[model samples]
Target chain A: MTTVARADGSAPELLDRLAADRATGALSTRAGIFYLSAGHVVHVESPHSPDLGELLTRSGAVPPAGWWEAVERAGTRHRVGRHLVDSGRLTAGALELCQLGALFDAAYCALAHGGTVLRFRPGVTHWLGAVRPVPVATVLHESWRRRELLHRIWPDPAVDTAPLTRTGGTGPVALPPRRARTLALVDGVRTAAQIASASAHRTFHTLVELRRLAADGLVAPAPPPPAHPATGAGGAAWDEPDTALLRRLLDALEAL
Target chain B: MPGIDESLLETMRLPGARGALVADWISGLALGAVGEAPGGDAEATAAETAEFARLAVESGTLAPATPAVPATPGTGSPPPPPGSEPPVQDLILTTADAYHLLRFVSTPFDSTVFLYLWLDRTDGNLALARIRLAETADRLVLG
Candidate 1:
């Protein structure tokens, strides 16, 4: 039994050691707790997990400006959902969904960064009924469902990360589908500004679209090529007689 | 507030209701269900539906397909800083014969549960069913 100080320090190390040992147990960290069995993560929870705050903020249940302070308070109390509800940051229903989203997100992140670093402890109790983090398969499935929902709301996937680029060339470009057009606007060349301008509709809408585009392989940053010298027959060693001969041939052909 | 069983029963009352189930997406567990068994099985169906959502977001089919415009020669758009929230959401699947809806409900605790509803295509009005489901969700109490 290896005892360590601080949840942060012990959590990551325990995950690594568990992976090395191929053991199964619950690993608890300041961020959250997750379950692992047979070198596979099965569940996760984080202090600041999911989209409850965002949902509340977006739905007008909570003031966006007060989110950070609430999160800070949650750090000490470790009960963000309750805090938000008690403070009237969000209604009970919204709080539940947000907490669910956070739980799903944390579990997804852990599984995506896979390889046995989680385990289950028979006697340990973590807040939020998190016995351990969920398996990668489970996390992945949930994440996929969430992505699909976003897609239905806004069909295009290009606006997920890179700023929205709105410039067009000389021709009239037919707009994408209705859902896509609503999420993306064609500004002349201002990407971030366009997104910021549209942020009033929803702060994360543009961002989510960008992320989806990137995920779909529809858009990507063009990588710069390595520097290399030009190579052709036009080097200094080229014969000067070639031009003279060509001129003579042309003159002869014209005389004919 | 309506209990889980009552909600499932209410869902069954909808016209052309082939089947209905209240699922916890996080665990893929069927809390309550009514009607015909889904062809593939409940757990498998839930898992597949969830996977569809994740793939859509990861692949970017949810948004437009255009490159981010580069900033002016002298300026560059700031990188999305680290520790930002990832943009994603729960999913709904519709078929020619049935309408499937999954909604995430927030609980007082940190648990996120979803209600999955399956409606028969031939006899159900998709629009009306969605509205009903949303209303039903309002009164549900998660355990």
Candidate 2:
């Protein structure tokens, strides 16, 4: 593993440099990877973010079978997005929206995982092809703005990772369809990530809604998870000294 | 139907068009934008526009009443009336120098996106713009 050290600079800087160089292909960080084409960001995939296929399938735009077929048939064609559009499974517009939403969603999490071991493999394209290439500047700017919006509503970062439950006092306030859909999935046992997986809304948007709901006093953080003694030492993956140092560096960078 | 990029370009073709953006009001994120922003900051403008959208759609005073669904006797809350139109079609804000139109776009899927058009008040025709914007919104196909 090509461990990217704190001396390599921040994730934003790395992306900026790649864009400046007009680099093409995948930049793999330990947390996830960002795929670029001709310097523009084409796709981003992170474990913390729900997959684009799942988001699209759940959106009722294309059925699961159609999505699976697209993935399977992408093979050497590398035109998964085009296949879907040509097959009338979805419109070019809808595909663009889904790709854009997923890009921003995954990019945010990728940037958050700043200190991971970073490796860039040139000419590595995603199977989805390029739905639409978003400018790197816009992607970074929007992610930063989204982070601010979340903080404005609920400053506690803990609210983001914890399971949520209704506060139970405010009379039913009418929620928008997506928010209502998301709220229905918040069963008090699922974290924000889990809730996003269950709902059709994009993961980032779901988290934003959760923060908004938190601000409205409609939801509160569930108590911490019980201590699992059996899981000890097995969780050593995140305890690397470099990882801790990188996280601290990221925190300092974000604070700036 | 025009995808977001083409739609945005079409919007800017309107007379006196200052700028245009396709924004998801729920999350205050811009799907796409062209030309300049009113405040010179697209992100800030999106957030401000979202506040308007959230208010217009959420407020009972502003939300249009749905075609009434017969209330069931035993259900705690009645089933929502079928086929309710979106709360607001478009919101037009006439400032001293510009005409700001927030046209909500509907989709077969959940519709939370809207077109924000900023036109110079002196030269832009509001009536024509309104009609064209609605047509654009109708023709828009969101994936």
Candidate 3:
């Protein structure tokens, strides 16, 4: 709790300044690291969003061995994405979509806490390179819009951190295929973040589906925490959220 | 193979093509865009079109039978592989003076995105645009 947003400038402000300066480097926040090129957000890695490898290989897009090969060949130069495309193992369109999806998915959580910019290293770049560079204004605006959209669907954020399970009270609950795939993984043990990785679904899309499920009374949301100090502005708490999430978040955040 | 920028440029070359965007339905993001946006705001248009596209794909009546699940078991009609043709290939919305086409882009992984092309009805060929848009979706590279 005490570790969040100690600086007067939060995520948006810090990013705005960097964007204004047309800075190219990595900006570290409490939630994740955002790689910027000439003030544009090129890549992002966060605990809330599954990494590119998981999004690709875990979804059966590329075999584990093939992915490993790409990393071996291109990891050092931060061109794993380009290498995958060039090697014909993956399409440029597919890689781009995945990276951009991963970018916004994680960036939403990264900016959610309004965490202070922990540290910024000039000229530091992601190993994935610049797959799709988006302006800082667009990135920031999209993050805020996503938060608003999710809130409109379901105001409470508890469902986000809660483990989900079918109500099981009703038989034959018809659902869209995507939501069905997501719901099928809700075993009351795996939370939304786990479901995102396991299902190869975008983090925000997973949240949208879960919020809808909660709206439909299909899954029980975690009861609102009692004014936890670790919660974000909208009562979003990644801490003690299934324990595993917190640990991974810590490892990912600390490793930076 | 055309990357996003190049693909959009190709779309712009189409007759009556006012603008086009590589929009992600799931995230409602414009991966790339070229030319004009109907509302004069590309991002807002991307979000709205994405919302419309998602509803179409999610609604059982609109979406084709699940591609992953074959209708008949052991009938030799195996379901399409993942990342194959999307359940909804393309959606055409006819407006008062324009045609909005959303062509879903299939990927190796679960795909939830499309190419949105806005064309002037008088200048654009719906049939040709449909064919070309689909071709663009097929060849539109990302990396």
TM-score of each: 0.43, 0.81, 0.84
Candidate order by decreasing lDDT: 3, 2, 1
Candidate 1 chain B lDDT trough over 10 residues, lowest sum: B76-85
Question: For model 1, how many clashes?
Answer: 59
Off by over 4 Å in 3: A1-8, A222-256, B67-85, B141-143
Cα deviation of A181, candidate 1, in Å: 7.8
- Please state the i-RMS of candidate 3: 2.8
Best lDDT goes to which candidate?
3
DockQ of each: 0.08, 0.35, 0.45
What docking grade does candidate 3 earn?
acceptable
Where does model 1 exceed 4 Å of error?
Answer: A5-61, A64-78, A86-88, A113-137, A140-218, A225-256, B1-18, B21-37, B43-116, B119-131, B137-143
Among the numbered candidates, top TM-score falls to 3
Q: Which ten-residue region of model 2 chain A has the weakest summed lDDT?
A: A236-245
**RMSD per model, one decimal:** 15.9, 7.6, 8.7
lDDT of 2 at A13: 78
The TM-score obtained by model 1 is 0.43
Order of candidates by TM-score, top first?
A: 3, 2, 1
Global lDDT of model 3: 0.79
